[model samples]
Structure formats: structure tokens, C-alpha cells
Target: MTAQAYCPDPWTPTAGENARTSALVDRFVELEAQVARARAEQATLLVSLAEIAVEQGRRSGSESEYDFATRSIAAELGAAARIPEGTIRGRMADAVTLVTGFPATFAALQEGRISEPHTRVIVAAGERLDDDSRVEFEGIVVSRAEGVTVGQLRSFARAVAEKIDPVPLTVRQAEAMALRGAWVSPLEHGMAEHRMIGPAATIYAIHDRLTQAATKLKATARAAGEPDPRTLDHIRADVLADLTLTGTPTAGDGLDAIHATIQVTIPVDTITGIGDDAAFLTGYGPIDPDTARRLAGNAATWVRVWQHRDTGALLTVDSYTPTAAQRRFLTARDEHCRFPGCRQPARRCDTDHTIPHSHDGPTTVTNLAHLCQAHHRLKHHSPWRMRQGPDGEIEWTSPTGRTYAHKPTPMVRFDAEAEVLMPDLHLSDEPPPF
Candidate 1:
């Protein structure tokens, strides 16, 4: 037998050891400086690597400098770095901004007087100012960096940038409005965050409406001698979600028409209480079985999809009108865009024929896939090649002949009872006009 590996116990201060605790605290202070220096070194390396990528791009005459830098760094660093390529590119750009525009701020960061977050705040605001104005803005921000918190630093920098901006306030407002949109981010505890960027006045009005409804509901609960269980913030969030989903304050018996269609696929066994399998929310991944059943009960329409049990391959997609029902089937199968790394939901994407319809490709389930607008254009304009497998898997070939396969992540977890429930589910013979 091989020798057993030795694992050391984690270091911890003994109780009542004031000297050890003080020494540990002092060491930590020294480590903070070490960490800052390490971070500065890493930034320098990243800058050098990005410069090398630019030189390589010039020599190869193939990929752009940015594409080369992002792909190269992401590939070399791997996912353990926990930084996305876009973030890496953005940080490299910020590093340049700091070194060129705010030397004092960068020096403070290197010396551990200020942090990377502080540097980022300065760089972000300074980028908006003219060269002459940026120097003045940097002077104001860097002086306060060591003393102020990151949040305060951001606020101060923003204030300085606004005061020093060369563009007229109206023009800047127009530019800011052009950037408005909704963004989704993953959060802890199996939840996700939704952020909307828009006019402050419009947002405030919506918030006021939600607050009014929440307050009224709270008062109603109190008058009825019932506990006001949810907090004001929670009630407001629910109200916002309810309005956004159903386009009304109250969601009625069935799901209402909205901007995007939500599709949920649940095993018949779970729906009928035979099994506890979770349902797949088209773009959002798996939700609890109870939520699935509740949503299904309120669905305006449903399309039944059939697939092979063993391989999870599409068996026979229902033959329907080449419009609504067809879209439902594809959305159920693909869940999101067929692009290699994209997660844009099918509802917001365009269904494109894998083979060009101009070349006589039929508009059928086997020949169709959902692609976000950006990827759809890329498919047509770029040299990226695509092919569909017999089982609806997508194979993408990049311009450099690198091939990647994309298969939809299935929502169902297999159990022996799945076979028993299969015959009773998703077998609707009716295909009414939608």
C-alpha cells in the first residue's frame, strides 16, 4: 500500500492568546501590501501579454488584437482565473487608462494606499473627460482615494467627471439614454438578479406605484387581522414581477400575454403527483416541481414534445403550422440560442434555417434553430460553418477550422417511473391555431 498523505491542521489562534492575535493582525497588514504589489505585477504582465498579442496580430494578419488578447488570455489562464474574456479585455483597457491618465492613482494602488476597485472607479469616470479635464479630475479623485470608501470614491469620481466633461449635459443625457436596457446576472441561493438601466424619473415612478400597492396590501392584511408576512421590499419585488410577467397588478387564472413567452416542460408523472421531477423553465433552467405545476396550470397554450428516452433525441416533433406551434417545439428543444457560448433565450431570438431557405431548405423542425440577432447575423456574414446532427445537436466550425459541438442541457432527471409516465405525457393529437 502507498503511504498515506499527511494533511496539516489549519492554523488558528488559541483562546486568550493576545500576543498571537496581535502578531497575526500585524502580519495580515504586511500581507495586504504584498497582495497589492502582486496585483500590480499581474496587471503589468497582463499589459505585456496584451501588447504581445497586438504584435502577433500585426504579424499574422488574421485575428484582431482584441480577439487575440482575450482568447489567448482566457485559454491560457483557464476558468480557475474566474475572469471572463470581456472582463479581461476591459481590465486591460482600464490599466492603460490608469497608467496614462491617472499615474498618481495607479501609484497609490501599487503602494497599497488605494485598491484595484478604487483604481477602476477612477479609470471609469476619467475615461469620459477630455485629456485636460482628465488630469484635473484625476487630481481630485486620487487625493481622496486613500481616505474614501470605494462607493464614496465612485460617487466622487462621477461628480468630478460630470463637472469636467466637455460635452453639453443634454448631449450626454442622450448618450446615456442610448445605453438603456435590461441585464441579468446570476446570484446566490439559486436566484438571479435583474437590472434595468433607464431614466431615473421613469424608474422612480414605477417604484412609487409598487410601493403604493404594497402599502395598501399591508394595510388590508392588518384590517383583516392577518399577519403582514412579507416586508415592504419583498412586496414591492413581487408586485414588480407580477406586473412585468402579466402586464397587470393581478395575475389572473391563466398566464397573460407579455413581451416574451415562457415555456415550461414538466414530466407527466410530476404534474400528476406520481413523481417529484422538476420542470424546465425554457431559458431560466430548472424550477421547483410545485412552481412548474402552478405555471402549467396558468399557461395560455401548450405544445407537446416527444423525444427518445435513451439518447434524449428528438423522435417526432409534432407536425404543425410552420409558425407558432413549430416555434414552441423548437424553443422547448433548444431552450436558448444554438450559438456555442450564447445563452439568449429562444423567445427573444429569431428562428433561422440551418440551411439557407434560398437554397431550397424546407422550413421544418429538423432544419430550424433559434439564434439571437447577433449570432444570426454572424452566421450569415462570418466564415463560421454550422451543421445539425441527426439528434438536433449543433456543430460549429470556426474560421480557423476549430469545431465545437453544442447540445441543449435537458431539464429532466431520469428515474425508473419516467418510462411509465412517458406514454401519458406530451401526446396531444390536437394542434389548434395559435
Candidate 2:
């Protein structure tokens, strides 16, 4: 037998011809333990350094030393290869000091609890404050962090802002506040359409543009009693145009055909007590656990199920029964989607049939699979399709219908250069350290 010829065993580890498989297992365990300790230490050091750097900036008046300290820490972190410079500075500022960086620094504020937005206000305000006042301001925030819940923290921030520097005090502020204490100056706004060429933008990006255009057209729409500046049909068409303008793989017959879809309307019952649609997990996107459980809870109650061996059992008004062996096969062969490059846990992935259940596929281990929601939808609706090849690789076909073979996820591969630095499990009590 050769490596890559068969998947490595979870319990039975076979090594070089004469070595005991158990020895390989022992080495693996030892290595795992070592990695755990290294990660824990790294997290502690990083957070501790952040705390120290913030203090030094406050107490050490020498601009040269502060600059040197910052440069040194940044350099050290960069060399580590895993730490992002923007992320590092932001963490330190939010968690320890309040001098530099914008959004990243805000993250430091929650320590681990609040959120990026909450910290942004503090950093934005700090920009206008003098060094002494800024540090004083940070001190107040740090004190509040010890006992503040999320709601209290937001309120406390308002109090802190008032204490440090209540709204710009000079002529610039008087002119900026045309509407009194109601809003930030309109001058602060800027339009950002990062990909104007593309037809598809995020709902967040779309919302911003809509806000800008809405304000510009607000008076006319309101006078006419129109609900929106633009009609829904216009928006949808424009959005499609947006995606097309942005470089989607429109040239390919493979799934760049965004216009296609398969609508599967399985009749749903009011799941015991839940009001929300119970989501079927396809892969690792964010769906609630209650949704995952709903399908399972009502599995037996499904009077008629459309059993697709590879995709798992789906209950419609139609029905069928599985042999006892098939049930055991489902439990053993498929815990989740077998798609490479995905880790949503087995339970969260859809149980797919290796062969089409509609084509009289057998309910056997070799005929089962699990795909997460994203991939599942792609399989059924998009131009993308899946097929088990002769070599055992699950080939994914694109919109153009070209098949791309996805290798299994390298879950076990941890190169020395690729490991994530450990997060501080314990240490600073500030912000909460998300």
C-alpha cells in the first residue's frame, strides 16, 4: 500500500514497513499537545505586550521612545508571519491604549466583548484630543470596561465623550452643527463604490449607495407620496447589471449563468413551536442550530419522504421506507457533506446521495454524502453539479458544465508557517477580548 492510495485511518495508523502503527499515534498525540501549549503562550504574550505598549505611550513622554517601541512591536509581530499589522495595532489600541488606528483599534476597545462600531467612536474622538487628554479619556473607558454590560458600555462611552471633550468647542463646531445636536456634519460623508464596474455589490454597499441617492431624490419622492426613490424592478435590474459590470465569470458556461435556478418548495409544517423557517444546512454559512434540529426532530413524522441517498432524506408529501441497514449506513458513512474545503461538522451538512436517489440509488455507505447549504443550493439550483468520478474524487461541474475536481480538505496539515497565533485565554480584563 502507498500513501495517497487510501485515506489515513483514525484508529489504525500504519507507518514505515516495520514500525508499529501505535508509535505513529503516540507521536501525533505528543505533537498535538506541544502545539496547544505554544498557542496558549503566544496569545498571553500578545495581549500582555498590548497592555504594556498602551501604558508606555501614556507615561513615557519621549516621542522618540514611543515611536521606537511601536516600531519594534510592529516589526516583531510582522516577522512572526501570522499577525496582521492592521489587526495588531487595532487590537492594542482598543484593548490597551487609544492613540492610533481606526477600526482595528476599535476592536481593542471591546477587549473581547463590545464590537468594532462601539470602539470606532472612541478612536474618532481621540483623534481631536491632545495626548494628555486622550490618555485620560482612555483611562475612563478602561475603568468602565470592568463592570459594563454592552448597553452600559455604550451609555458610558457617551459619558466619557462628554468628559473628555464635549463636541468640538470652537467656531468650526458651531458652523458644523447646523441642525443643533442632531447629526454629524454632512462634510464627513464620502461616496465609496469600490467596484462600480461590477453589477453585484454587497447589500451593505448597496444600502450605502441607496442612502446617498435617496437623500438626493428625497424631496420629489416624498412630495409625490412614493415609497422609494427608485422602483423595485429598477433596483433589481440595476443590481443584475451591477453584477454583470463587476467581473463575474460571465464568459464561462460554467455557473457564471446567474439567471438559472431550481426552485424546491418542500411543504413545511409549523415546526412544533418555532416561527422561523427551519434551514437545512448545506455547508458552513450562518444558519441557526434550531433550524438544523427542526428537520431532524420532524424526520420520523415526515409521512412521505423523498429519499435521495447521497443528499440525505427529504420529506415531502410523498414517502418511502429505508431498510434498517440503510439507516445504519447513513449514521456511519455520512455524518456531513463530504465536499473538500468545508468544515461545518457532519450534522450541519446535508446528507446527499452519491448516486441519484431518483435513479434507484442504494441506501448504502458508498452511496452517501453531506453537502453544506451553500454547496447544496449550488448543486441543485446553479449550473454547478456534482458527480463521483472513477478515481473517487467528487467532481464539481461549473455553470459552463466543466468539472473541477476538489481534493479533500487538508484538515490535518499544519505547516510551521501557517498556524494561527493563540488568542489570550486569560490575562487582560478590559473590553472582553472577542
Candidate 3:
């Protein structure tokens, strides 16, 4: 046991009766901190040992680190502790990280400035690099320490992962991985199938609903039956249970599309003007009433109807007062992200107000259009704005304040009586004369 193990925590504790309660609480916190430190050190030591083990393996005919850590830590802790070989190696792997991370991590822990998750992250980082590889990592962490606190180092590491053997963690990395993960691929595929076959649903939302519905089926099965019949395990259970569990997929044929959901932030005065039954139109063209407000009885994401002056056409929007329905409607009508050849689906695009709402841009069809998150950020972070004309054409102003005209959509109509083209196929239109 170390001296730090007896140190007190700074949190103002609960009300207690005994005089020793304060000291007890402090000691308990100290013990927990010490345990945390021990876990981290164990991990760090393991990392250094792994380096040693790897070197030894090269020298002694490909021996594993598992053998080395067991022999090493056991001698230090003693045989009576009867530590398992894997446990010691795991601990040493943990220790290897503390070689660099300990100073910053311990400092944060002692000061109670960081969450346990953060400390564990550094510990894990060290283990990944180990001893021989860690010096480079130490440099990276030190170089990254400032922004690394925000976990951006992981993001940065992940962005250029091919250069590093063990890729770092980051939001972008997670998203890419999510798209590639086996389960997510099927989920996205299912959503795509639904989009093409059933309705124009937000792919992400459809996956979520399917996952939820699947989970509910699983829970229901578990509650009612034993031996989850679906399993091929030794213990025989209800086979019907497993079949019943994957509910959402079975019900998918009957599923309806949940169109666009936009988050609206606006002033109260603007909402009063849009009368009740203010339904926001989803991107795929379904409208939802003020149910959020009706359910909570507090104002939220109120919908608005924007009537075009010349066209007499109405588009819905979501704002603190304005709705994004018009934004959704415009994006789908345009096809793809309006950014030249972006190819990102219409549903994923962010409906950006060409004139920022802060500048009093109305949530009308012409004022709203979709851009993917990257371009939406570009529009804000860069000096850019988008303008829509009555012809439904969008003009984009670049960061340099230079404007580019986006070409109009090509018109096509089926001519049933026209001569067909293609050797074995036809597009149901007349071919242009050669």
C-alpha cells in the first residue's frame, strides 16, 4: 500500500452521523484512486514487459510475451499471490502505457480532473504501442497533449490510419468503421432495400427502428420462454422463440417511412404567427403535426407552412419557429446533394438556410436547400452562401465570394411510340438521330 492510498477526495460528501464518517469517506476515495493507479500501472508495466518479451522472443526462437510477463511479475508479487500468467501480461501491457501516459494521467487522477474512462484510454494507448514502439507514441502524445485532452489526437491518428499499424480512435473513424462493420452493412442494406422497395426513409432512422423492433422481439421472447428456442445450444429451448425474436425484419414489409426530422431553433414570437395544426412536411413528403408540443405541452420544433408568392405552393419547415420541411422538399426535388456531383443521398443532406436565419431568412422553399454535413460546415466555416431561383436552380457563392451557376436538371419524358435504342435494351424514349 502507498501513502497516496490514504489521501482524501475533495468532493463534499453526504450527510453522516459519525465523527469518523468524513475520514472514512476520504479513505474510501483514496483507496479507489489507489486501485485505479494500480490498474493503470499494471497495464503500463505490461506494455514494457511486452516490449521485453518481444525482444526475448526474437533472441530465443519466437517465444510469446505471455510466458515472459508471468515469470517476471510473479517473482515481484510473490508465489503466494498465485497470479495468473495472462493477468500479469495484461497488467504489464497496461504498465507499458504509463511509461508515457502515467505523468499526465496520474496528475489528472490525483487532481480529480479527469474521468476514469480518460485514464483507461491513455493506458490502452500505451499498451497498443508497447515499449519498443512507445517512444514514438510518447512523442505523438506529448505533441498532441494540448488538443489530445479533448480526444482529438485519437481522431487525428485515425484519419491517417494506414501509416500507423494500430489505428487511433476518432468520431470520423467510428463512422467509417460503422459503415464497414458487418452488422451495420446489413442494417444499411436493409434500409436501402426499404428505400427502393417500400418508402423514402432516412436510412439511419430505419436502421434504428429495425434495431429497436428486433430488440423488443428478443426481450419479449426471453420473458416468455426458456432455452431461447432459436439457439443450437446443448440445452434445448423453444425454436419458435428465436423466429419470433427478430420482429422488425418480419414486419418490415408493412413499415412506413419516417421522413425528415429537423431540429428547429427560433424565437417564440415567430411561432405564434403559424397557427395550430402546424405540421412539418418530412423530406419524402409526409407531414407531422405539433405532436412534440402536444405531448410535452412545451413549445418545441414547431412546424410552419411557407406559401410561395408567385407559385402559390406551400412548403413546411422546422425552426425554433420555422420548419425544415421546405428544406427537405427542396433537397429531394433537386436529387443528390446540390453540390456538383456530390452523389450523397438526398436524405443525408443538411437543409441549409441560404440566408442564415440569424439574418431573418424565411424558412421558405427558395431559402432552404440541402447540403451534406461537410458542405453545410463549409458553407458556415467558409465564406459561402447558396441562392435558389424561381426556376429551382441553385447558385453557390464560394469562399472567395465568387459565384458559380449550378446547371438546371435535365428534363426527360417517356415517348411510348418512339423507336427504342440499345442492342438488347430500351430507355422508353426516341433516340437522337446520328
Q: How many pairs of residues collide in each model?
A: 0, 47, 27
Worst 10 residues of 1 by lDDT: 420-429
RMSD (CA, Å), each prediction: 26.9, 20.4, 22.2
- The CA lDDT at 228 in model 3 is 41
Global lDDT for candidate 3?
0.41
Candidate 1 per-residue lDDT, tens place, 117-198, comes to 7888888777877788877887887877776557545544665565567664446656777989999999999999999987
Query: Candidate 3 residues 104-218, lDDT tens each?
Result: 5555544444444555654554545445455454444433333223343332232222123343223223344445422222355444211222222233334434443444445
Q: Which one wins by lDDT: 1 or 3?
A: 1
TM-score of 2: 0.29
Q: Whole-model lDDT for model 1 versus the true structure?
A: 0.61
Best by TM-score: 1
Q: Model 3 segments beyond 4 Å from truth?
A: 1-31, 40-83, 110-116, 123-207, 211-248, 251-434
**lDDT (C-alpha, whole model) for all candidates:** 0.61, 0.41, 0.41
Error of 2 at 284 (Å): 3.7
Candidate 3 residue-pair clash tally: 27
Q: Pick the candidate with the highest lDDT.
A: 1
